[model samples]
Target: MRIGIVGTGFMGTTHAKGWVETPARITGFCAETVAEAAALADQYHAKAFASLAAMLPEVDVVDICTPTYLHLEQVRLAAAAGKDIICEKPLTLDVETGAEMLRVCEDAGVRLFVAHVVRYFPEYAAAKKIVADGKLGKPGTIHLRRCNYRPKKAAGNWFLDDAKSGGLLMDLSIHDFDYARWIAGEVKTVFSTTVGSMDKDAPVDYALTILTHEDGTLSHITGGWAYPAPNFQTGLDINCERGNIHFDSVASAPIRVLIREEQNAPDVGLPASPLAESPYTTELKEFYHAIAQGEAVRVTALDGLKAVQIACAARVSAAEGRPVFLEPQGGVL
Candidate 1:
């Protein structure tokens, strides 16, 4: 498989690092400018294209790591070129365009995978397995927290724009929203509240969302952009009929537990994983195999769209200070 990257920011660099671990060949890169593309391409010993149009014919997959607002156009171009796509999270700023992108890819007979890397994390993956294996009966209540500093950006950067970045709910909290839906079930309604501002000069942003699943399972998600660098942390606690699954990035070990007796505090002190490969790399490798050999991946374009739908509903709930109801989804792609 041959791939062409289309961004040069942090995610772009991180994706590139993962792509290198796959069997796919990194064919080229196309950034906001040819110079930027060339800089990243040079590091990977790949070609640098002046435009996506120029890069399309040279690769089988167009890896889109561009900003959320720019995804629709880039994805359309890639689909038009008859190439598969690997888009980063949030998919887009809204579900309408994300659905269109999925439709375009499907019509063109190309696979569309979204990078929801949290699902691929070792701790999260382990939790998923434990839940699936019936170690924890049915999930009841889930609490997910992701906190990190505001993205380091220059003045007038798009990260500060609510319309472009979708603030913290879509940018950061979408991970939890997606994970919540994945672990519990489809969302039936959402109620959310937010603090801080989306102003360019604002130093912080935060949101808390509550999702009521179709099966009555509840998920509360919190996202914040007020921490210092290197202080970023993610924690998840899932309560179930049998036991609970817990993980905190700041802990010595992120783990899953099976409760036997209702007496005494459950013993819990699992150790950190010794594996060197990152969840990002594992995600990309899975995507590569799915595209190259027709395997199933954890995240698809429809999943991405639904994630956006959930996040958008949260945005609306926050804006209106009322619970937003979601209709049963049919075919959008």
Candidate 2:
């Protein structure tokens, strides 16, 4: 399969690397400038197309690694050209646009795969499997923490712009939001509190969102771009009626599970295995295989839409200082 990548930023470069690990050919790239696309194209031994329209005919699949706001137009262009799409996460800045993107792709009979890479992470994937397998009977409370320093190299300071990047919650915390919903089920309500500044000179931003799932599972998700130290950390603690599963990036062993036994016995911790390949690579490979085999994608466009909806709702909740309840149809009401 031929692949054309859009956006020559960090994510665009990362997608190029992941695609190289697969059997697909990196046909070329489309970016803001010829030089930007050429830089990435040179690394992959591919061409640098001058425009998305020019790049479309050269490839069967378009991998969109552009910013959140650019997704709809890119997806529309690709779908119009009858090309399959792989879009970067938080599909679009809003629900209507994301829904329209999905509708266009479906009407065009082209596959739409959203890159929610966290679902492919070994630890996170295992946690989902464990919960699905009933190993953690009736999950109750889930605590997820993801913290990292703000992107110092964000050109034009776009990452700090709430309208552009959706600030820390949409761009950074959406991973945890997706994961939480994946494991806990549909979110019924969301209550959120945000602290820190979006000022260009400010060094920090943080947000905490509490999600109540339809299944009665409560998830407390905390995300930050405010760490003084140069460290990235992500951890998950899932408490269930039977036992619990935990993973901390800072821990000696990243993942561990404990299951209750014989009514009242000591909890026995079981070690979780590590992934041989990066989740990004795995995610691309899965998308490739799904497209090749005409099978269902693991991360569907609807999943991406729901995640963005939740994140957008969180933003509303934080702004209004009230818990936002979601409709059964995945909209805040």
Candidate 3:
């Protein structure tokens, strides 16, 4: 398949590298500037289009790695052209836009895949499999932490603007929110607290959110841009009735499991495995395969919509200093 990538920023470049590892051809790119698109296109031996409309007919699939705010328009254009779409996380900045994007793609009869890459991370994927296999029994409390320095190279410092990037919670913490839902089921309410600034000159920002799931599972998710260095760290702790699973990026062995005595399960310790290929590659390959085979994508557009809903709710809870209860629509909050 021929792929057209939108944006030439970090995520766009990352997606370009990922598509290279697959059998698909990197047809071209459309970015904020022709110069930027041309720079990335040169690295991939591809063309640079001045606009999305100009590039649409040349590619079979459109990989949208643009900023959160640009997603709705780019998706609408691509879907209108009958091109399958691969959009980056959070889908859009709010529920209304995300819902409209999904509706347009559905009406166009084109497949839409959201790139929730955290789900493809080896440790996270393994933990999910364990839960699916009933190895953890009924999960109870989940704690997730993802911390990193604020993006020093984000174009125009967009990451600091809550209006543009949704600050740390929507852009950074959304991963943990999606993962929490994946493990614990639907969220019933969200309570959150935040610290620090959204100012461009601010050095630190942090947010902590508690998600109460319908199944009685509680998820405490923390995200921070307060790290002094340009370091990234993530960890997860899952408590289940019969046992527990844990992962820490800083740990010698990142993944560990322990079962209660009555459960009679052997403990498992998993050291991080060296990757022959990046998880981004694996994620893109799966997306391509699903399109090719006319099968269901691993990450659906609805999953993306729900994640945005949960993240938006978290923001509301933080702003109002109260628990935000979710009302279900067609069994999804």
Candidate 4:
């Protein structure tokens, strides 16, 4: 498969690297600024295009690594070109555009996969397997935490702007939101609170969200760029009918388990594979397989929509200071 990439920032670079490591080929890299695209292309040993339009006709898959606000337009362009899409998360800054993007892709008969990398993380994949294998024995409740310092500065300029990045929830918490959906089931309601830096003008850097699921499973997520830690920290704890499973992002062994005395402790460590191969590679391979074999993607556009819905509801809850129902005004995609 030949793929074209849009945006060459950190995330774009990560996704591009994943593609490079996959069996598929990276045909072109695009950026609004042609120079930026050219630089990334040189770095990754791929062709450079001035814009998405220039790359659309040359590739089978369009991997959108642009800002959250630009996703709708870029996805729409790719759909119009009849290329399959792999988009970075937080489908869009809002629900309307996200739903529209999904609709466009569906109508175009294009496969749309969202990069909810947590779903593909080795530890997460392991945790999912353990849960599915009945080791967790009917999940009861979950707690997820993802936090990091914004530094005295941000890694990128767009990330600091609320208009482009969707602040903290659309930018960061969506990771946990997607993971929570994968682990705990459907969300029923959400309540949230946010604390922004007094010095920043755009969006809050700190946020905490409580999600109530349909099955009475509760999920709490806290995320921010406010922590003084040197690196991002994330993890989850699932309380189940039988036992509990915990994973810490900061740990060398990211996953761990404590079952109710029946089983011995299991040490979950990151596999000793080459850096070129990771859950990101696994996910990219899945996308390639889906395209090659004409199968449904594991993480569909609708699944992506649901994740955004969850994040949006959390955003509303935070702004309103009340628990908001996770009701899709139109319906689920």
TM-score quality measure for candidate 3: 0.91
Clashes of each: 0, 0, 0, 0
lDDT string, candidate 2, 139-247, tens digits: 9999999887676652576777778889888988898999998998899899888885233455678899999999899999999887644456789999999999998
| lDDT at residue 328 of model 4 (Cα atoms) | 38
When summed lDDT is taken over every stretch of 10 residues in candidate 3, the lowest stretch is: 263-272
lDDT (0-100) at residue 14 of candidate 1? 82
lDDT of 4 by residue, 1-333 (tens): 888999887677777767877788898999878888888788777899988998888899999887888899899889999999999887888878888898899899988889887788777778878888996688887888877766332345677677888778878888888888888778888988887533345333888888888888888898877654344577888889999989876575434544455432112112232344677777888888888887765577777888888888877877778899976334555
Q: How close is candidate 1 to the true structure, as a TM-score?
A: 0.91
User: Which lDDT tens digits does candidate 3 get at residues 1-333?
Assistant: 999999888788889989998899999999877887999889888999999999999999999988798899999999999999999987998998898999999999999999998888888999999988996699999999988766665247777777878878899899899999899888999998888423435568899999999989999999987775535678999999999999988784434455444432111111234587778888999998998887665678888899899999989988878999888657532
Rank by lDDT (best first): 3, 1, 2, 4
The global Cα lDDT (0 to 1) of model 2 is: 0.84
In model 2, where is the ten-residue run with the lowest total lDDT?
264-273
